[model samples]
Target: MTPSAIILIVLGLAAIGYVLGRQRALKTAQREGVKLHSLSGYHGQSVALFIAVPALFLLAAWLFLQPVLIESSVSGRIPQSAIPEGGARSLVMFDVRRIAEGLNQIVAGGDVSENDLADMRADVTDVRARLAEVGVALGSDVSPIVLQTAKEYRATDLTASFVRNIAVLVVALGFGAWALARIRPGLRARNISETFIKALLMGSSLVAILTTVGIVGSLLFESISFFNMYPAKEFFLSTTWNPQFRGGSELGILPLLWGTLYVSFVALALAVPLGLMIAIYLAEYAGSRLRSYAKPAIEVLAGIPTIVYGLFALITVGPFLRDWIAQPLGLGSSSSSVMTAGLVMGIMLIPFISSLSDDIINSVPQAMRDGSYGLGATKSETIKQVILPAALPGIVGAFLLAASRAIGETMIVVMGAGASAQLDLNPFEAMTTITVKIVSQLTGDTEFASPETLVAFALGLTLFVFTLGLNILALYIVRKYREQYE
Candidate 1:
């Protein structure tokens, strides 16, 4: 049975349990002529939770574990010779799994009978061609041994799926019947239901925490592997950014880091002041009608995708900067440069800063403004001295968020700033950031074992650490000044 079908069946059982449990509780209360410990709805909810939660948990665990067990069993049968030179066993298993899925598709399509599929050999039949007929394209021709292993894998997976469906249904039905039987006037059904809900909420929070840990853990492990193959000192300290797939590449990160900072610095310098001023006007001076229309109009830029901004940079802004400013001043000739990307990204960041700062400024108490006014300060002075200081922490937060967005931006950098990693100080010169290099390094056919590909993870880890540091600094600034303001 399919997972969706199993879920539907479990839900049906839970619904039935709820109805029966509620009826039983009501009947018991009427017959005994006593007040029920919990309401009929709570009894129903308790029954539903008992029926659904454990069964769903079991189903999720089974689905996750089945692949690991099946792969372990099937991959053991694959000989070392079957793994191509310079290829890992995992890649071979990947092909085996794909072949298995393709075979299943063929059987489901009714082009091939199960008996015939079991008897067929890779040598006797064009397995790849058959799979292709069902829209499963293989990278290479399948070997006989690999084909046999895939068949076994399919058989094992089907059996496991069948068992999983049966086990889940049985658990759901058994628990549901047990809960229904326990329904009575004295049962603390509300307590049980509430406890289960609390547990579910806690589980959701843990899932989020674990997900973050998993991402960081994966990056750290791969980065360690990359550092083992490449010198850490050269990667961190040297001022070159070149990667040769053939070998002996100078994978220094300094140039990429410099470009990232330079572009982000330009973007933030453009965005922060304009955005803050816009926010101040909207929050402090603009009439209601003007604020309503203008705020949304300005915010529409935030809704625009970064790729669209990149295209705008490439087609419009880049050329204009090159021809009007760079050519006239003899700065540089290239359309794709750090200045082009930074200006476009800065434009993209405007709405983010303005909207956030506007909200933060408006959140300041009106009494503070009144107090400043009563103290004989003018409107502008009150805003500058009272409102702005009160809103500074949140404004700093908005700036940090915008800075992070600018740093991580890829499409704008790719289209506006050409992918030439260098440490040039000129904004008109073509340059690239770590994000662009990470994408380039991982693009196309890649071997994860090589330093060239693994370097992407190292770059990712470095970016993560840099962003973390920014967050920490923002927190420190907020805490240090927040007391004085309060």
Candidate 2:
């Protein structure tokens, strides 16, 4: 508690001191007789920033590095005879921590000791007592080199903290003084700030760009390996999709692609109208009270973990759909089928599509609806004619996004969609999706250097390309339509 409070106080003082100092610096820079190149506020900001940044960075570094330095020094002090070579460093560090803790425990409770426990206990007490002293002896004689290393490390750390604090003060005073002297009528404070902000934005964007490049590079290398094993034509054109490499297996994609498309289409068919209607009702018809109660209820679906949804689809929804809906309509088998996975996926997508569509529908100008109303148009007529047309492009954008989400969905399909890649139109029959196959290929005992494992990369590349294209299209339509309306 004492250490924590001290740290908190130091941090609080630094921040408050920076802000107050900055304000004073600004006032000093803005004085009548001062010759300045930058604004008074900029000079103040420079002072405050310097006062805060360097000292805070030093404090953070010390807090982290101190523990590691102490541990390493203690490990070096432990004799080679006490602990062996390979495990020596780790054992010394562990025992160092335990030895101190055990002595603290001994102070509280006189516990039984192992061999040489009294000596170990004394050593711990000595180390703790000497820890604060600049170059004090550890009563039990350690090697001269170890003692010198510990002393040097402590001195270096103290020196670093002192220098860092000085640097902070110097930077704060120097920047404040410089900015005060530089301030003038022609200074461009806003442009300088904007340039700094732009550099930060570019740095952030580079992180994302690098991550995307890495993913693409990984997929490209694996896909190239896969293409070399089996001809690209056979992979794309062959009707069969059995990926088992037991005896020089046949690797085809048509069956998997068919299953993927069938499940996606089924999900879209279930999701689109239901999601659209809910969006319309929420946006145009629902009272504010009802919307407040209902909107979050619908969104709650999104928050439910995907694993739970997968279980629900497997244990509850799948059986229910199979027995009640599919079996009744003579469409699907007992539990696992394309319809089960698709229906569950559709339920998952409803909140996503409805939420986006509702926002777009609401964004259609109220004046457009008013004009239609002024022409003696009914609520339904106004919505059907004026509102829907205006919001259509955005709605399309939302649907495309939902489609991409459904395509990429893994858990529900893995649990409910059967692991059989078959080229059949029967909705009741079991089917496998690209994601399920990817999981199957990679999981359990599997060789990395095989065409079977590599196929997952090819599928991943396809999925990435497809989603990328969809996103680009959606963004273009949304942007163009937004411009039109604006």
Highest lDDT: which candidate?
1
* Tens-place lDDT digits, model 2, residues 1-486: 223553554455555554654455455546655655565455445444444444455556656676687666656665666554555457445544543443334433535343333344333445444333423323334333333344444444445555655554465445544544554434554455456557657867987998899999999999999888878898788888876657476767888888888888898999889989999999999999999888899999888877787898899878887888878988866688888888888888899889999999998988899899999999999989899999999999998998898888889898888899889888888898888888888883556768888888998988889888999999998888898766
Candidate 1 local lDDT, 331-446, one digit each (tens): 99999999999999999999989998999898788899999999999989998999998899889988998888888889999999999999998999999999998999899365
- Report the number of clashing residue pairs per model: 0, 8
Q: Candidate 1: global Cα-lDDT?
A: 0.92
- Per TM-score, the best of the predicted structures is 1
| TM-score to native of every candidate shown | 0.94, 0.67
lDDT of 1 at 345: 96
Error of 1 at 124 (Å): 2.9
